[model samples]
Target: MPCVKIDMIKGVRSPDEIKHLAEVVQEVFLDKFAAPNRDRYQVITQHEPYELIFEDTGLNIPRTEKLVFIQIFQQGRSADQKRALYASLAERLEKDCGVPGSDLVISCNRNEKEDWSFGYGRAQFLEGDL
Candidate 1:
């Protein structure tokens, strides 16, 4: 399972647009990361323009108010999986959400099954509830 956090500047997209964007990301996760159909866990946060900052990091890619920052936290995933995820996200986001590859930044973090607790003050993974 992966928990995704999508951050962007407020007012850049309408509410429907944001929902569609999240759905697009979820699709990528399902196709590339092998996430379960009901395993969707995502948070979309919109901040004021002044609350977000991004730089090209010397890649010379242009940054804009439409920038999207996505953080994916999950368990083991192979490097190839990550590569495909990145490529698919870029292409699909551009084609479906109008988010250019240059304006998208993604970071994936690794964790263990024990790190998640779905509910009830319990470690569901450890308890075999998941």
Candidate 2:
């Protein structure tokens, strides 16, 4: 399972645009990470310009108000798959949503399947509810 949190500057993207971005991210997971089609877990949070702050972080890549920070919590995947997923997201987001890949930031936190509790006060993956 992948639970995504997208942070962005408010008003930079419309509600529809955010939805499209989520779709693009999930598609990459499906294509490269073997994620199930039914596993769609995504959320977007908009912040006032003053609330979200960042710099080049030594990459020297300038950012703009359109910046999107995507954080994903999920089980482990191969490094190669992660690489492809990044590239694919960068490419697809820029092409489909008009947000340049340069404006995107992605980070992932990996955990065991036991870490997830889908519902009903149960650990679904571990308890076989999934």
Candidate 3:
């Protein structure tokens, strides 16, 4: 299963946008991981630009624009699969979400059989949660 988390500016928050992002992720998974349904993934969006605090350290945190971060975890996928997935994801995300690839940070975590729980009480995708 692949889980994507995006952190962006508050002004960029929109349900429709998130829905599109999820759809893009689902499409990528289907083509790369052979995941049959969108239920195999989790996508979370966080509005963090308004809350970033780094002034104390003299580090500037840009608030005028948004920086998006995507983290995905999937098991039983090959290296080629992961590479293709990220490549597709980055392209689609930039095109569909209007977020530039340079502003988007994506990470993929691979898990072994004993490393993840996708069924029953674990983290299976939920409908209403979206």
Candidate 4:
């Protein structure tokens, strides 16, 4: 399963756009990680323009434009898979959402089975939820 959270400037996209983004992410997970149809995936998107800030803390500088941050979590995905996935993701995002690849920053992290509790504090996948 791959859970993704996208944070971007507020008023940047409509609901359809947001759903398209989620679909794109899901497609990437399915194609790259070989996630099954029964796999549970969740994606939460937050749009905050006024309060959202992009800065270079190391250089003590503020970024002039908005940025898209995508955080994806998968249970068992290889580094090579991630690398290839991001490339395809960026291209698709640019083509579908008009978000340039340069503006997209994706973070891929590993999640162990013990870390997720789907329901009732259970780690196993529920039938209906899947």
Candidate 5:
């Protein structure tokens, strides 16, 4: 399973824009990452303009209010697959949501299958109830 946490600047995007952004991200996972619908776990958090901190991180990319951070936690993916997923996320989000790759920071943190508890007070991946 993959869970995405999207953080963006508050008051900069309309409600519709945020909703569409989440949709675009989910579509990328479904189409490019091949994740199942049952695996969807997406959360969006808005921060005041000054509350969101960012840096060039030596990439020399300038910061802007349009910046977004997509933190993904998941298990079972090859390096090549992860690369493709990142590329597709940048491309699709730019094309569909008008958010450029330069303004986005996408990171994936791999975890063991036993780390997730989808619901019902169970670790479905280990319990075989998924």
Candidate 6:
């Protein structure tokens, strides 16, 4: 399972836009990351204008209030898969959510299967419940 965390400035997008953004993300994960169907997990956090900060990091990529930061926590994805996921996310977010590639940032983190526990204080992956 891949758990995605989306961070963006508040009031920049409408409620329907947010839902659509999440859906687009899920679609990219399914297509590029090979995440299973019905296994989507995401958290969207809206920060106040002053609460979030994003710099170009010398990349000369101008940023705006529409900046979106995404973090993906997942298990053992190949480098090619990660690259495809990033490219697809940028493309689809731009085409579908109006999020420009320069305004988007993404980080993927790898973890072991034991790192997750779906519920009941049990390691579902280890317990064979996953």
Q: Comparing 1 and 6 by lDDT, which wins?
A: 1
Q: How close is candidate 5 to the true structure, as a TM-score?
A: 0.93
Error of 5 at 31 (Å): 1.6
Q: Write one digit per residue (lDDT tens) for candidate 1, span 25-91.
A: 9999999999999999999999999888888889999988889999999898999999999999999
Name the top lDDT candidate: 1
Q: Write the number of the candidate with greater lDDT, choosing between 2 and 5.
A: 5
Estimate every model's Cα lDDT from 0 to 1: 0.95, 0.85, 0.65, 0.73, 0.87, 0.94
Residue 5's lDDT in candidate 4: 77
- By lDDT rank, best first, the candidates go 1, 6, 5, 2, 4, 3
**What's the candidate order when arranged by decreasing TM-score?**
1, 6, 2, 5, 4, 3
lDDT of 3 at 101: 63
Candidate 4 lDDT by residue in tens digits, 1-130: 7777777776677789878887877777778888876674665556556665555557644343336778888777878899989998888888877777667778888877667777786666443343
Worst 10 residues of 1 by lDDT: 49-58
Candidate 3 runs further than 4 Å off: 50-64, 118-130
TM-score preference between candidates 2 and 4, better one? 2
lDDT of 1 at 81: 99
Give the per-residue lDDT of model 6 (tens digit) for 1-130: 8999999999999999999999999999999888899999999999998888888889999888999999999998999999999999999999999999999999999999899988889999998887
Candidate 6: stretches off by over 4 Å = none
RMSD in Å for all candidates:
0.6, 1.1, 6.5, 3.7, 1.2, 0.7
Model 3 is weakest, by summed lDDT over 10 consecutive residues, at 52-61
Segments in model 2 whose C-alpha atoms lie over 4 Å from true places: none
Error of 2 at 106 (Å): 0.4
Clashes of each: 0, 0, 0, 1, 0, 0
Candidate 2 lDDT, 1-130, residue by residue in tens: 7788889999988889888888888888899778888988888899999998878789988888989998988787888878888898889889988878779898988988888778788998877777
TM-score of each: 0.98, 0.94, 0.69, 0.80, 0.93, 0.98
lDDT of 6 at 78: 96
